[model samples]
Target: MIDFNKEVDRLGTYCTQWDYVEDRFGKKNLLPFTISDMDLEYPDEVAQVLQQRLDHRVLGYSRWKHDDFRNSIKNWYSKRFNCNIDSEWIYYSPSVMYSISKLIEIFSKDGDGVLLNTPAYNAFYDVLRTNNRKVIKSPLKNENGHYSIDFEDFKEKCKESKLFILCNPHNPTGRVWTEEELIKMINICKEYDVKIISDDIHMDIVYGSRMTPILKVAEDYLDSIYICTSPSKSFNIPALTGSYVIIPEAKTRDRFENIVRYRDFVNSPAILSVLATMTCYNDCEYWIEELLNHLENNLKYTISYLEEYLPQLKLKMPQGCYFAWIDFSELNIPGEQFQKMLIDIGEVAIMNGHVYGEECEFYLRLNVACSRDKLIDGLDRLKKTIDYIKL
Candidate 1:
């Protein structure tokens, strides 16, 4: 079993989450919690496999044997979610969002309506806007601490848009949508003929069993919907190879592929990274399960600690992913102010919520996928800083 309590030093690992904090956050040494990457190393077994592949020393162009890649991907979804995925329906892309941009080109036209839930992964907004598509914002309603979809508003907005870019197990808020929720969401999009482009990057690492895929929840075979997924976030293999784009509809899939003809984005990583990602899916199953349990423990402990000692700062432990959407509105500070205060004063780095949407002015996202001791230390620093400033 993977050791959940183990800590790997990432301070100078040339990481966006760790190494980039100084230039990005304007602090010489910031206590960073802003980025989505985990501060832990990949499993030793996985590392060994990659190192073995690296021993060949010649890094050159790679090709997909097709079947080998398909089996690894199909097996992951079938084993994890019990959803049947046809390998024929899968396409290759370097990054999930890169494909999302390509889908915007395929499914949507300039001046066409594109809808997004507010408080998304910032990149979603950037991609849509870069393509000159009109972005429609449908903000989720905050219920207590966790946020839920406003179905009524979602339906109305979907009616007006031709495409919807959805974030499953949603970013910033961390809502692991249930099957019922996914269907209701899809049905509404279907009614308006909106193509559902779901970003299922965070499909794994869920803390609860209630969450399922948008396709499973979607009643009937809604060919218009697109499932863009990757194992990058799931296994911490973003620097590795590619992502999967599953489109059940032949016509739509053809259109997506046609969009790719004008550009050259089918860049697969080194054969080593590809093999490593596939290996993680086929063999690292046990490690993922153990990691989820440990992360859930961290989320629960952090929430309880905040409630008992730092009541002014509100945090809702999510049902999926390693993110915690924290509300600091009670502290009467702006999101950036709180983020800077956390770094400058509390010595803890965290995400500023404003970039997600205007509605996130008082929220910040924190990653709890660290060693238990690091998480505890970060929490204690946050508590003292927030409380000390409260007076």
Candidate 2:
């Protein structure tokens, strides 16, 4: 039984969430409910595999195309989602973002419009901007706390866009896309000749919500679909730097391999990341199950806490991902002021929503993947910030 409440000290390890809060928040030692990485420990099996590889000490250029790597991923998808993944469809990348950026470059030209649902993963914005592509927004409708895509708007955007970037089990607002929702988006993109890039990095961690992998629904439309995902988010191993893309079309896969090998010169996988992936995918199923239960409890606590105390702050329990996207619009506080107050007055570091997109100005994304004790402290600080505002 994995102890999800175990508090692992990460402050001195050059950790981004704890040690480097000052970099983004401009303050040190602030309790951070920021950064997507978990405060929870990963499975011991991952560490054991990594240690076994480190004991060999060769550290040479490592290939990721072996049966061990491919079979582990294939079996995981089969067991977890009941989705069959072909070994040939899996190709390695250093990270999910890298694969998405490369696919954007491969499929679209500069100044070409890329359709994205607004209030997306903030990094998607960075990827589009850095690549010189036009960001065309099809904002999701927020009715009360529930979020759903506006297909009419999505269809209109797809007509003019060259590619559509999707965040399955979407970040900030964790709406796990239903099969019906995904099929609609896939068909719209197909009609417009728009290529699809589904970032399913947060595929795990779903709470009772079914995670319909875009590949599952895109059987006939495989040529236009690319699924970029990683075990990094699931296993808390982002530092290991391993991710992959699932491209069913042989010609498209070859084109992407050329970009990764020749253009990026990313010939070898990170040895430790490969080993960690294999171990976690093959051996850590129970760990994920336990983590999800913990997250669900944390999420329920968050929803109950807000309802009882800070009823003004609206939060809908997210269907997937361990993030609580709380609407601060009812507070009527300006986004900039609210963020500053959280940092300076409450001494807490929570992500302000405006960075995601212009539509999310009055929201905040809180990381709930922490020990329950730490989550309580963060919530208390948030309450303090609200109290100060009310006074």
Candidate 3:
């Protein structure tokens, strides 16, 4: 068993979460529970594979269109999700966002409506705005901390949208889209003839539920659905910089490949990234199981701690991912001042939720994918912030 409680120092490593807290929070040495990446170390097997590759001492261009790379992904889907993935459907990209950005550019003109749920992954907003696509927001209905889709609002927005981006096992809120949810969404997009891009990057880190891939439910609507996913979040290797998109339509796949190869000139995956993917998917299943258990324990601790001390702060145990979305609206604190206090008085660097969407201004996203000691310390700091506000 992996000792997840063992703390590994990440300071001075140029780490975004640890080393650069001041950039976003305007305070150095604040305890940070921001950033999606984990503070925990990646699976040892990934490091082993990378080291073995480096020992060969020949870092050359590497193609990802081979049996080993494709089969690893195919086998992972089959074994983990009981879903069959065709070898032809898998295509490599540098990152999930890159694939999404390119797909938006390819399918939609500038100013065309691109629909997504509000309080989304902030980077989605960045990508859409950078490409000059109009963001069509469908606000999720949150009832007593449980979030659900407003299908009526979603369908109405679909009519105006050229593309719909789905975040399966969604970030921040951590709602694992059920198979029923996926089918409903797929049918809506199909009815409107809107292209779908499902970002299932958090598939492997689920709790108490199975992650239904968009392709699983959109089998009939395969031509319009694209799945952009990677092992980066599950394995905590974003720095390696590799991700992929699963496109079922032949013509669309060819067009995307053209842009990736000739237009963008990004033909090969990073040697270390592909090796890490293969190693993690093929040999690190045990590590993932342990990681999930650790995260679940952390979630339980967070829920209990909040209920005991900071009961006014509302939170629901996430269905998946390692983030706890806590509602601070009950405290009646203005979003901007509350954020400032968290930094100045509490000396904690939790993410300001307004950045995700205007509706999220009263919320804060806390990262729980750390050692229990760090989690306890972060929670104490959060409690300190709340106590100070009450004074």
Candidate 4:
């Protein structure tokens, strides 16, 4: 039984989620429900294997070219998602964002348009802007709190862009894209000749509908699509810094590999990172199941707490991911003002949704992957501040 209740002190480990929040907000001792990583401990099996590898002390250069690493990924996809991934299609990278920036460079040129849904993962915006690619937003429609892709808008935008980046089990909103949704989007992208770069990092953390990988549903479009995934989010090993891309088409795979080699970016997977990922895929299913149960309880508690203590903040319960997308529009406060009040008076730090995109103002994305004590403390602070400010 994995203990989700244990509080881990991550204040001084250079943890961006906990240790750097004060620096980011310029407020010391602020309760952070912001960043995406969990406050949970690594799975015991992963931790043990990683430590064992570290003790070996053969810290020479390594590559993930072995069958053990490849088979772990293949079996994981088959067992978890029921998707068949060929070993040859898999290639390692230092991180998903690094792979994505490279994909953007290879597939599209500067000033050329790349598409995304609004209220996206914020770093995606950074990638596009840094690469000098034009961002074409195809905003998702919010109907009675559930989010749906505006298909017509997406189709129109596909006509204007040659590349589309999809975040399945989307960030901030946490709606797992259905197979039908995936099919429709794939069809539109296919008709318009748009290459898709699907980010499926959050697939393992799903709650409601099972996540359908674009690769599984759009086999015919493999030549123009690829998936960027990592065990970092699933296994809580971001510091290990390993990610991979699945490109089934040889020509595209060769082109991407060439760019990586040319840039001398053939980053060998860390010894601990490789062992951790292998452990996650091969030995940590039970731990992940327990984690899902804890996350479900956290979501329920958060929704009930908000309804009882702060009904003005409407929360759309997430179908997947640990984030809660909350609507504070009824409070009659601008998002920037609301965020500032939360930080100053409440001493709570959460992602101000406006940074996600223009349409996300008045929404706050709260990360709930923490100990129950910490969660309750943050909620209490949030409620106290909102009440105090209303008076």
Candidate 5:
């Protein structure tokens, strides 16, 4: 046993996931399992690399020489997924959300519809709506504890839609979509001429055997597929940032590059973050695998606890990510109330599923990336809260 719990207390000195977000809920203290950010410390090697970079001391403009960034990314992808990536496909910017918003502006004219599958990451809703763009949702099929995309609905949306935002290893639902699913999805987008901006930020955290980056599956059809990925999720360092978009064609790539240039957000990150990103990808495999194992075990423990103590609380163990989308619909309460009840009474602050989409009422998403003990404590608090409420 890796004792992932004490490690959190030891390392989470300034953890935003654990220490921050108190203000969001207006609480004096909070046990927040609401965030997607993990409470784990970086691997010692990554820490060492950053320290070494800092020792060099002058914070100045940094540029990538040769294939440093791409090579690190390529090596990580190959080792993790056996998927070969290229330096040519690499294009970067600071924000994936910013990049996605830019594409919404590019592909869709004013008031055009952009397709999203719900429940999705809460960020997408703001990203679409704040730009005065319209959001059209074709809800995921949630039958018998499994979530699947409604292909017909997706295709239908394509006729009226100009852009498709894909959350691979999807958030909230935690389905690490199969290649067959990705292939059919690609074909539908191709058939309907709906351009795809696939978000694979959770690409490296899958609980399953594989996660097919949309581009890796849609290789021949790459001109239409825009894949966004980052070391953020894998290394738990979104703040120290940059993300790359893989566009297969020169024209599509150039258009994005031009847009990024216009926005003035296109530039290589400083050595501090870029150096950590490079090292995290190139090294740190064992720690990542170990972390995944811990998360998988955490998910298993959560499921088992629910079955034994709270069987009415239903959730399928997600095939990817540490997010547990537990359906508390049987309680017949609004998801927000349930989340608040958990926080106010149970003292466990979790994300309300309603934030994901309209269909997610009466549900909550718990991030289980903390130590096993913290997860167990959260589950215990949840069990007591529900049991008391029911009584």
Candidate 6:
């Protein structure tokens, strides 16, 4: 009986989610529903393994590849996604963002168009802009809270873009890309000669359905895809900063590896991160199952709560990630204004949707990866703020 109900005091551990809220917003005691990191404690099994490794105290420079590391990754994908991953395809990275940035630099050039669906993970925009690549938005249609990609528009955009970063189990929106949808994307990218960098960090967080890896579809089109994934998001060990990139083609993999080497970004991962990752993939299935159950219940509660009390707020329940993509347009307030109201009156921190891309100004993305009591508290504050506005 793991205690998902126990509220961990995360205030003083230099936590960005909790400790930095005051600095970022000039508000103390703000209920943060903003960052994607879960509020739940990490699995004890992983922690125990990490501690055991730390006790050895050899902390010297280490290597990324080992039989155990590769086997753990292979087994995880096999057991979870039913996807056969050739161990030869796996290459280590410090993080998913690092891999994406490196791949962006390798595959595309300054001013080359990087296609992204609007209301994407906001960090992708930062990565593109910082690298001097042009961001091409192929906006996802928000048809009354359900989000779907427009294939025609997507294809048109792909014609001009060099790379497409697909977020399966998309962040903020939480729409898990179906196999049919993924195949459609692959076909379009194929026709346009556009390469794909799939950020699958959230691959293991699906609620009821299994995650579909783009690599599974990219077998025939191996040269056109790069799959980036990490256990950080799945196992709550992001601070450990360990992730891997999967490149199916030997030439492409060599090219990527060469870039990593030339750029001096190659180094052994933190020993603890590797150990924790191996422990997680090999030993944490029960913990993940429990977490999925808890998150699904939270999703259901959020939907029912919105309907019962705040009908003006439309929620498209996420199929995978813990984020709830909520439409607050019925309140007739701008995204900034709504965010201001939430911060000032409600004192709740949520990511405003507009930052994801243009034309998402009426939406707010709430991180529901916390305990029920905290969730309800945030909801009550939201309700109170809405009621006050109505008055």
**All candidates' lDDT scores?**
0.80, 0.92, 0.92, 0.88, 0.82, 0.88
Which regions of candidate 1 fall more than 4 Å away from where they truly are? 219-221, 259-262
Per-residue lDDT for 1-391 in model 6, tens only?
A: 7778788889899999998987756787899988889999999998798888889978888887778888899899999999888888888888898889988988889999999987899899999999999999998987777889999999999989999999988887888999889999999999889999999989999988898898877757777888999998888998888789988889888887877766566756787888888899999999999998888889899999999999999997788898888888889987777788888999888788887876888888888888999999989999988998999
What's the residue-level lDDT of 172 in candidate 4?
A: 73
RMSD to true structure for each model, in Å = 1.8, 0.9, 0.9, 1.0, 1.9, 1.2
Those runs of model 2 whose alpha carbons end farther than 4 Å from true positions after fitting are none
TM-score of 3: 0.99
Error of 4 at 191 (Å): 0.7
Whole-model lDDT, candidate 2? 0.92
Residue pairs of candidate 1 with colliding backbone atoms: 31-349, 33-349
Models 1 onward score TM values of: 0.94, 0.99, 0.99, 0.98, 0.95, 0.97
Clashes of 1: 2
lDDT of 4 by residue, 1-391 (tens): 7889899999888888777888767788789988778999989888778778778988898878789888999999999889998999998887899889988988999899999998899999999999999999999999868999999999999998979999988997998998889999989999999999999898899885568888888868877889999988776789988888998999888888887766666756676777788889999988888998899899899999999999998887788899888888888988888888888999999888887998889888888998999999989988987998789
What digit string (tens of lDDT, one per residue) describes model 1 on residues 240-293?
757778888888777776665445646444576677767888888888888888
**Displacement of the residue 195 alpha carbon in candidate 4, Å:** 0.4
Q: Which has the better lDDT: candidate 2, or candidate 5?
A: 2
lDDT of 3 by residue, 1-391 (tens): 8998999899999999999999998889999999899988999898888899999999999899999999999999999998887999999999999999999988999999999997799999999999999999999999998989999999999999999999988887999988888899989998999999989999999998678887887778988988999999999999999998998889888999999998999878898999999999999999999999999999999999999999998889999989999998999989999999889888999998998999999999999999999999988988898898777
Q: Which stretches of candidate 5 lie over 4 Å from their true place?
A: 1-3, 10-15
Clashes of each: 2, 0, 0, 0, 0, 0
Task: Show model 3 residue runs off by greater than 4 Å.
Answer: none
When summed lDDT is taken over every stretch of 10 residues in candidate 6, the lowest stretch is 259-268
Candidate 2: clashing pairs of residues: none
Task: Compute the lDDT for candidate 5.
Answer: 0.82
